[model samples]
Target: MWGRRRKHRPKEYFIFGTIQEEDRVIRINPSLDQPFVPLWFLRYVLYHEMLHSVVPDETVSGGRRRVHTEEFNRRERDFPSYCRARRWEEENLARFLR
Candidate 1:
């Protein structure tokens, strides 16, 4: 599955990458070039980004995207390595941002 920044977004589509809601941009990490990463992990990130579509507060306030709300965090933990994955992403986003 690919998540491209389309010229026109369809009514309903599942995105598997980070989406810049303000700009309607969808960015896929090339480092994830290989799809061998666990589906759970991939899904975790996708859903994480999808949350932005609903969380308007992330933009109005000058704060980090609360990818993990108290309930989101509690529920996301069930995905396994949720914390670890987030930490890994934080530590390695620089290498993967390209």
Candidate 2:
């Protein structure tokens, strides 16, 4: 599932994407729904959130929920253009805040 759009609030930290696991939903930040954002980058973020739905979460000793385990990270790199998309985010994230 998808398509929940909302405006970003001032002083609110940015979130590029998120997954609601129980609902099996993936949401892309409305800021990224622009022509300037590459399609590959959008796909990368959507894919990342979708992974949270399929990948099993780990419960640690303190009963902490760990979403991004080693295997999850490894699988994330399998996405084509992963590195390029991440680099693009690092370089241009500030621009999206607008």
Question: How many clashing residue pairs appear in each of the predictions shown?
Answer: 0, 0
Model 2 Cα lDDT, one tens digit per residue, 1-98: 34556654654466888887577667777778779999999999988998888789999889999999988999999998999998998999788666
lDDT score, candidate 1: 0.58
Which is the leading candidate under lDDT?
A: 2
- Give lDDT per model, in order: 0.58, 0.83
Tens digit per residue, CA lDDT, model 1, 1-98 = 35544555434433347777677565654445565555556666876666556644332267556554566555656666678777766664554433
Give the top-scoring candidate (TM-score): 2
Candidate 1, superposed: residue stretches over 4 Å from native = 1-16, 20-26, 58-81, 87-98
Error of 1 at 50 (Å): 0.3
Please report, as a residue range, the 10-residue window in candidate 2 with the lowest summed lDDT: 1-10
